[model samples]
Target: METSSRFEAAIKKLYTAFHNNTLNPECCKQCAVGNILDNTDSWKYLSDDHGNLSLNYVGKVHQTLGRKFNGYSPLELLQIEATFLKACGFQIPLNHTNKRPENPTDNDILFNGLSATISLLCEIDNIPNVMDYQKLFKYKKTTFDYIVH
Candidate 1:
């Protein structure tokens, strides 16, 4: 799959923000994941009105799709990001029993969630949507995958 320069720049900006101490690592993770989910139909079940991931979506994804949480079960998506924060050596508020104390363990394990999200977006025939997850997120838009403009 190709990559999008805009999306790559955005994620790079986020990384810079985290390094500059403007945006914390947890928020960086959420924004990264949220932006990904937002650009897809999974936004319906994964985000709230403000486009942030909600506990409701968390419960739904877990219950409906069996997408297991790496850290906390009964928690907000932000909490999951926070878990990643803790694993990354940041202090979390009201910490719980972390499933993986060393989180972002595999470069955010993004494929795990994105794979499931893609499954939900596809039809029973396993055909991918117009907004191919990787291509879209990577900002690699072609006429075949999606409209250029």
Candidate 2:
């Protein structure tokens, strides 16, 4: 079991879980990178010497999804993740305690920001069917490959 294979298996498991409606976003947020690292056995792989498993795994997922994942960095991936969540109707947490802004364009800005992130990730990770994220959020696809890798 190598790092790449492990990464593929983990992502596949995620894909299956997502399709089965059993993945808990809350749990994913809690463990984040650590969860992937710990689950390598289920997937069968290990991190490289540089602790670059997350980036490498994302790249592999991108390739497996038929998109290029080398163009962006983790920060960029974070941005995309934020946007994707927004497009899926998830609200962005506001730092200000004041009431939410009443502007309609606020949602548009949020969506564009997310879309840009997704597009960038798709380019870097070589993910296929960039539109699939939108579809997945909309529950249109039974299974979708949107991993940042």
Candidate 3:
């Protein structure tokens, strides 16, 4: 299936970060959007609080200006981060007392987070989720002929 260059780039970045032990739900520079943006924290300025789906003033300005970072808008980046954090077992908006995984860096936790983030990315682009394997299990009908003696 063909995907946009942005989608491909984001997947590659997330894959590298996941395997490199750089993906962290609590860190701005290592979060899903951060990795997608090449480990830059600039995207954090797009929102006032981490794990927030709403864009702040700066983010609003960027969105209004049609500015896209790494092929994602500020709002999209925030949504992606929120999705990752939530899937990783953290409460939205990131409070210290909120429910979160005991080990945020655990591979399983991070994998779940990455999976959700990737799903959201695909949704944003109106493409099929890359991690979805259901299609592979679908049965297809084929015609066959049998001759009886």
Candidate 4:
């Protein structure tokens, strides 16, 4: 399956961040969209709150102007963050009172978050989920000749 260059770049960056232990939901510069944007916190301006899907005034302006950061609109960035946070067991619009995983950096939690984010990215690009490894299990049947020992 073919994927857009932008998607490929974003996924590569995300994969690196995940393995490097730099992906953090609580930090703007290390979050899902942040990593996609090369670990820049500038995407935070796209939304008023972390994990918020609604874009603020600045985000609206960018979206209206047809601006894309790392090939994603401001709205898409916000949605990606929201999806990551949700998959990581974080309550939307992250706050002190919201429920969240005890260890946000846990491998399992981060993996789930990354998986969901990748799915969303694929959805946005109308491509198959890259993380789906089920294809590797497909096997071809072949007739085998055997001799009893």
Candidate 5:
């Protein structure tokens, strides 16, 4: 499948899983990207030794993507994935946890969706270099600080 379509399918799968409360360890094993994200490598890349993304984090992730995959830079791949995940109601940190705050913001339908989407996107071996689409999710922030959008 093409990158866009593959990404869309992955986002849909995540959206479904997110609402269904299926983004747990059970599903991660079956999910290509989930397995990767659950491990140390993915976290270490993003977290690195600093324990958080640095000023050059985007560049670092872009470089990592280039090394791991044959096509598309990090921006090209994440732009769509990020947008779709936000639209599906995923907050970055909330996605990683099984529990959430009492009230759900526009964000934090949970990161389950974003995490799944990212994980699946990583599974794609070679994304096309062409930048066919560019979408950004402009979500307003509240007290919650861990949001990726």
Candidate 6:
């Protein structure tokens, strides 16, 4: 498969895993590692360089959900988690940002719950993925060794 296509597939796999609640914390960590391996060069841009990609991803998620997660609520964390998953390359429709929400659907609830758990795991563990690390600390001057080791 082409590089872009491979990346898309990986994103879809992660999305599916998150949506299904079939992905454990270790699985998400592995996914993050795989993403780093696949997009190592992107890390240079995310860290010690351009940090806009991380902002874009987070902004897009917040914009879409119409709320900023305070990092305390599981639902908010899930939205952020889904955004991270989409950053892998799922092509989330940004145009849906302003849409009205009648009620949270099952898929929405599932994704939200899964994202919350995933986000907590990511925050607490060593995400061995360089890209993930970059996204998490792109604006900071801290070295990778300090964050990962």
Lowest-sum lDDT 10-residue window in model 2: 42-51
Give the C-alpha lDDT of model 4: 0.92
TM-score of each: 0.26, 0.32, 0.91, 0.89, 0.31, 0.21
How high is the CA lDDT of each candidate model? 0.38, 0.38, 0.92, 0.92, 0.41, 0.37
Each prediction's total of clashing residue pairs, residues at least 3 apart in sequence or on different chains, is 2, 15, 0, 0, 4, 2
Between candidates 4 and 5, name the one with more favorable lDDT: 4
Which stretches of candidate 5 lie above 4 Å from their native place?
A: 1-3, 24-44, 49-65, 68-100, 103-108, 111-149
Off by over 4 Å in 6: 1-3, 27-149
* lDDT score for candidate 3 against the true structure: 0.92
Ranking by TM-score: 3, 4, 2, 5, 1, 6
What are the RMSDs of all candidates, in order? Answer: 14.8, 16.2, 2.6, 2.9, 14.7, 19.1
Judged by lDDT against the true structure, how good is candidate 1?
0.38
Q: Which candidate, 1 or 5, would have the higher lDDT against the true structure?
A: 5
**Candidate 4 at 26: error in angstroms?**
0.6
Report lDDT (Cα) of residue 24, candidate 6: 32
User: In model 3, which regions exceed 4 Å deviation?
Assistant: 140-149
* Candidate 1 lDDT, 7-71, residue by residue in tens: 34434544554444343233333433333333223323443422233546555656576453322
lDDT head-to-head 4 vs 6, winner: 4
Top candidate when judged by TM-score against the true structure? 3
Clashes by residue pair, model 3: none
RMSD versus native structure for model 3? 2.6
lDDT of 6: 0.37
Q: Could you tell me how far off, in angstroms, the CA of residue 98 lies in candidate 6 after the best superposition?
A: 39
